[model samples]
Target: MKFAPERSSVALFVALTRAVREAPVAEGGRSLAYDVIDRLAKVINTPGFKVELEALIALGAREPVLNSALEPFWQELHMLSSSSSAGSA
Candidate 1:
């Protein structure tokens, strides 16, 4: 079944967050959460997914009052995805 980009993207993010929260954390949970988030993102295996999420991350960063602890995760996602896309092309 084909899904709208926005719907698929939002569902991916929601799944990522749920996976991150349920993940085991031995130390700083934020970093562990980031790792889980990164893994979850990679599972999508589509550059469009990364681009959509990256846009959301950028938007969130612009919100001064929105404390989105996703900078590191977003950066890692960007690097992995962009590099993979380049390699594929």
Candidate 2:
């Protein structure tokens, strides 16, 4: 079943958050959390998910790990957006 972008993002965020929170801290909890948040930011930043993405980003999440996790997602998001835009015209 296909999920609406917002719903899919939310689900992904929840799963990532859970994984980060439950993982052993000794294994780098802070960094893990940051990565999860970063990925969440990308998921939310998708074309139809911008508003949610902005809200999530505004929640005071700034960490190097999170930024790193988000790097891949950001690249994917850009590619997706560009491809969709091109397809539209």
Candidate 2 global TM-score: 0.33
Q: Positional deviation of 67 in candidate 1, in angstroms?
A: 5.5
lDDT of 2 by residue, 17-64 (tens): 654455444455455455536654565434544444443344325444
Top candidate by TM-score: 1
RMSD of each: 12.2, 8.7
Candidate 1 lDDT, 60-82, residue by residue in tens: 45542222444324554566567
For each candidate, the alpha-carbon lDDT, in order, equals 0.51, 0.48
- lDDT (C-alpha) at residue 73 in model 2: 46
Model 2 regions more than 4 Å off:
1-7, 35-39, 46-89
- TM-scores across all candidates? 0.38, 0.33
Best by lDDT: 1
Q: What is the lDDT of residue 2 in candidate 2?
A: 56
Query: Where does the lowest 10-residue lDDT sum fall in candidate 1?
Result: 63-72
Residue pairs in clash, model 1: none
Q: Return the lDDT, model 1, position 44.
A: 53
> Candidate 2: minimum summed lDDT over ten consecutive residues — where?
51-60
